[model samples]
Target: MAKGMMIVDGQRVNFDGEKNVLSVIRKAGIEMPTFCYYSDLSVYGACRMCVVEDEKTGKIDASCSMEPRDGMRISTNSARLLKHRRVILELLLASHNCNCTTCEKSGHCRLQELAQQFGVRRIRFPDTREHYEIDSSSPAVLRDPNKCILCGDCVRVCEEMQGMGILNFAYRGSNLQVMPAFDRKLAETKCVSCGQCAAVCTTGAITVKNQIGEAWRAIHDPSKRVVIQIAPAVRVAVGEAFGFPAGENVLDRLVTALKLMGVDEVYDTTFGADFTTIAESEEFLERLKNGGPFPMFTSCCPAWVKYLENENPKYLKNISTCKSPMEMVGAIFRDKYAAKDAVDGRTTYHIAIMPCTAKKMEAARPEFIHDGRPDVDLVLTTHEVIDMMQETGIQLGELELESPDLPFGLGSGAAVIYGTSGGVAEAVVRHCLPDKSKNALREISILGLRGDAPIKEASVTIGDTELKLAVVNGLANAKKLLKEIDEGKKFYHLIEVMTCQGGCVGGAGQPYGLKKSKEKRGDGLHLSDNAAMFKRAERNPVVAQMMAEYGEERCHELLHVSYTNK
Candidate 1:
């Protein structure tokens, strides 16, 4: 009942309503090492690295799970605590496959960093671990159990955040390992390839599938005309990999780098977003007019789309049929854009640089291919784009910024904001609303359908009807919304769902440990949206020209695709 205060290392610190002693210590600007602790997930208290000495009680407690009480005295880093941490790291390393030199997470592995920090020079225990085969069955993610420390971050994130318990602890004690149910391969499970597991994993236990070699192969082929499109989120987050601050836009520099890497032309996915918006807005308007399937879910997020198919098949009819911006651009490049530029589509290698790992799976979908050739030949994550740029030996900061190529390069403000959670709903209202007045699109923002909230709702007047819209991020949030919709407790004319928390900006393939990166990256998109020449997708001259040239029927043929019920 009294004001909670803690003495951390002789300094009087206020708990400030933090749930645990670890939170209080962290809030006081003291670094307490942790392995199984994630701010968003439930505390396991399995990692003893955060064990702190309670001077008042003369007891050691895992700070992550310990309650901060009034006048509690805590020693964060004592002699005994350091020795215990060192021993814990040593024991974890004894069985860990120490292939840091070749490990995918070599530079960013938390276990390796903690071991180095704790001065773990040698392991007293013998290396008795057996060979565990890598699980690279999923096209978007790879699982290497040898690198796992049983911290349970991946298992917790997959189950808690994604609502898909694809990864879990299996077996018992020394023989225990995290795996899919029945220890089946990841590809054989209900996993939707969102890659949140890889994003949360502290070690190389999980990682995005490395396709840098495949990209290089296409680049090296002289006969191939390589064209790369940069996604909306990539421009803001990719700069972080090069020591730049989060949400730093390096679009021009990115284009320059791709050009130097033998890319024939660099395009912006925002252009595709423009087309997708036009098509999707039309679809939403049509559905609204029909008065059926009241809440049409946004299908731009491939992971969310796949989740609908796999888990909520009855709602398949509720999902928008329009392909994502990535696929829309890929379809255009493979069918019409290449022909307009006098390049054979067959010889052109279309690569999409994206934020989400699920995009890799999306690009490989048979529905998006024609004549056995994928519309998008390769998919590269934000990290992959940075790695490829680094390999070129070009300093991104030193290079001059270059604009994207014409026709497929220009986009509206509505298109660029598609990178974040509520962005799709905002773009739809901006573009689809019948009113074209300058102040009409501004109403969407005034309705407060933007920000970092897990869920957002707004009402807009279209013609004589008022439509309610909801935007939700994180699959867990989406699951809760779906339950409400199914039970008739909540209803909306439109709902936008992004699988990852904070949408694509917080994707699994983003740079590691960039805290608050999603909020910052999303801010960049909003700034771009405000500064864009045209606020609505319909105002884009390029989109108008495309519509005039392709007509409504053909435009749908190129930018739209149907989903399959699993």
Candidate 2:
């Protein structure tokens, strides 16, 4: 990554010089309408909607595909460019479905908005009127081929971002549809049910198999005790569902809203994050002492675990035996928290607010059930939870703040950082290295890996062992790194790979406004991370209380978990 200069529309700019024309334009506060040019993943020039006029060449070029030169004059919204783009849209609508009024994605669909914005009132050519069937067989999502724009956003998201080749272009040109091999149902295919596809889809082609209605039914039930554990990531993302800014930690509001919606025992998943880190650090030391696997892979991400099960089952032995923070925390409440009578032990139900749709499937996995009951009974994405809160008449801006309940309540900054990339690996090192007599001290800036990046690398020393760390938020980067590791090219002691790009901060469950910033929203989680008296996990008072209550060795049994391949 080196610095260089590039000229865009007569404005001199400093760039890595390798970015595409669209990237350069965006860097200059100029937005180019595009269908297939997603910022987090690689470019796929399937849609010609981003066509722009090049002054020097006098040619209309797709800004996403064109590379910026030293002096390239480009007009992103020129008259000729708009005309050409509109014509392209007209042709697409003629062959495709354009029933925006009746479409499920009428308000949110990118294609629908673009059509209205461009004033594409009618299809110029004779309507092809093609009909396609929707596949609703998947466990966590549904696919409607009729709504697909063939922009390859879903395919690229699944293939590149999730590292799952469960989707591909089936048939050529006019008959092309994104589907699993041989048109098999997604549930039957090697689909990990990650919902990364739904995250990028511009149309209603894909969406989560939501069970919020069931939650509402249970909430209205007089006998059922509905309890919820809010994940760390969900707190930062829920605001987006109701037009709240992205990355805004609205946990206090979220808890208040959940309670308003008739939810009992509003718990924090950070309790589980702290508990997980404690066990993970111990697991690392045990593997280091015993002659077990050399490089331990994290298994908290169900999507990543599912990807490994489908693509690289042989490497399953390397995955750390630790349940996801949300799952682990829910289990504790169901087993331990209930015994203390937080809620009626017999009927209390566990609900989880997460920044992931994959969590829906994760909760349903047979393994997640123990003692004839699933650890989590219901899973709500950030979007669904926010919707629930709004429906119950809770004012998000005015909800009185309440601190988390004890007995797996208080959380530290390390738990807060779990919502970001590399936070898991960094937290583990902070908690474990000090006990191992590592010379390195805790540092908040883990090589600038906290924010959004394709791939971030760092190194640290634990006693004599020089631990190499790589944090990948995007699955595309994970695929590249895994290829290198599979080929026996490089060695890393630990790898923290999140399913969503930028970690859960950019999760699928997030609302549209996640593209915005946190400073403007003004939440306590964001402020707590900055002003924490002790930032690390090992120093957290609550975690120390847990260790004191149950001897440190007892953590391995209470919090630790293992994964299986195939």
Candidate 3:
């Protein structure tokens, strides 16, 4: 961290002046209004609301993209700045239909905040009222270009965060809107449906295919059993729904809240991940022994799996045959556990709490069907969970500890961290090694990936063998890895790919509000992982307990699942 002397509002302050102005300004308790400026991604400086006048340069520049220098005097709130800001926003409003009263993001829109900040009273530019159509074609997300500010935030996040690069600027000028490859609808493209775009949109241009109301309907319906399975990455970010900051553990409260919402049974997907590791590790060793695919890719991320299938089908054989933890857990609860427990019932409604939107597509995949019913019945984003709680009058502080149901209930720390990038591989390495020693597990922390750049790569030795692994957190980066693998440039024994950046921490399901940027809740998951007693897949007492009661034969035959190129 380098030092720089910056004068803001006539007060001199010491700033870590190496990077952009947004970094230093926020550090000094000053809010620099912005769009097109995300800390997790690069500063495009497109929305000039962060414009500040420099004493030395005599030119106003976007604080987000500017490099602070020593002795630089910056004016963040001058009349000149406001005028320019309002003009930029007003011109923006002309081509866009905000419909704030009805918009889901009305209270939390960055564009709306900027409008009020600049005191833009009237639409100076014609409404053109020239309407643009909304594309609700994607099962996971909907794109309303009519409300898009064209800040390129979605495009940038898709490119810099997820690395999917799906939302590229198409055509030119007035006709230029974010369009996917070949201008196809999102459903038809290599979109992956991670919904990072929806998370980044300042307006309600993009949103998850909301199913909270549907969930509520089921919860109230006596006929349907609304069983909820919480994903590992969800524990890290779901706290934000209840006003908990990033990194704060609210599992107890969350569980209580879900129980209040009328879920018949609340389970953690970590158990699924735990089961997944058992199956995957066994499969990994099998691959090594039989000399199968050199790289056994993790199939836990449906988005990544879809990318491989659609973009690089040649390497399909390299993918691990294990089903995603969510689906795997779903299959057991619906088919295996139902039969074993002798719970003769009608159609089972299984709902999964996930950090990625692509999961909706994954759940809908006809291939996921097991014994006539789909493995996963429904998928809800993190944001949707918060809505469900609010709708059901579930208070955050009043939540109590309600134990998750048995059979596929218990999970280890290894299972919890699967929400984060590199977590799955780390869990596999910890439990999958031939000699699962505590010393080896304690000494190694396989968490890789760096600096919000999306993908991370690292290697470690397991017993007599050194294992090479890659974790692609961003969807765009997943594309890059698939390309690298297809091109025969990079090689690894295993790869874990999550569709969202920062793993599930930056998931589309997380809460959102105005104020330019939202305080992230990422710690809840990490803290839960660190404090959990069981941390390995091989030795999770709950999974072991289940196996003992049901027999290893039963666990292997039903608890685990398989995948293919299709």
lDDT of all predictions, in order shown? Answer: 0.87, 0.74, 0.75
TM-score of each: 0.97, 0.86, 0.90
> What residue runs in model 2 are displaced by over 4 Å at the alpha carbon?
1-18, 23-30, 54-58, 68-80, 94-104, 122-127, 241-244, 337-346, 392-394, 435-451, 513-527, 538-558
Off by over 4 Å in 1: 1-3, 337-346
Clashes of each: 1, 1, 13
In angstroms, give how far residue 205 of model 3 lies from its true place: 0.5
Largest TM-score belongs to which candidate?
1
Off by over 4 Å in 3: 1-4, 15-17, 56-58, 121-124, 336-346, 434-437, 446-457, 479-490, 513-523, 545-566
Single out the weakest 10-residue window by summed lDDT for candidate 1. Answer: 337-346
Model 3, residue 399: C-alpha shift (Å): 2.3
> Candidate 3 residues 14-121, lDDT tens each?
876357777788878888888887776777888787889987777988888778778888888888887888888899888888688878777778888878876787
Cα lDDT tens digits for candidate 1, 251-314: 8888988988888888899988888887888888898778868789898888898888899888
Positional deviation of residue 204's Cα in model 2 after best superposition, in angstroms: 1.1
lDDT string for model 2 (164-218, tens) is: 7788898886777788898888888877776778877888888776678989988
- Point to the candidate with the largest lDDT: 1
Judged by lDDT against the true structure, how good is candidate 3?
A: 0.75
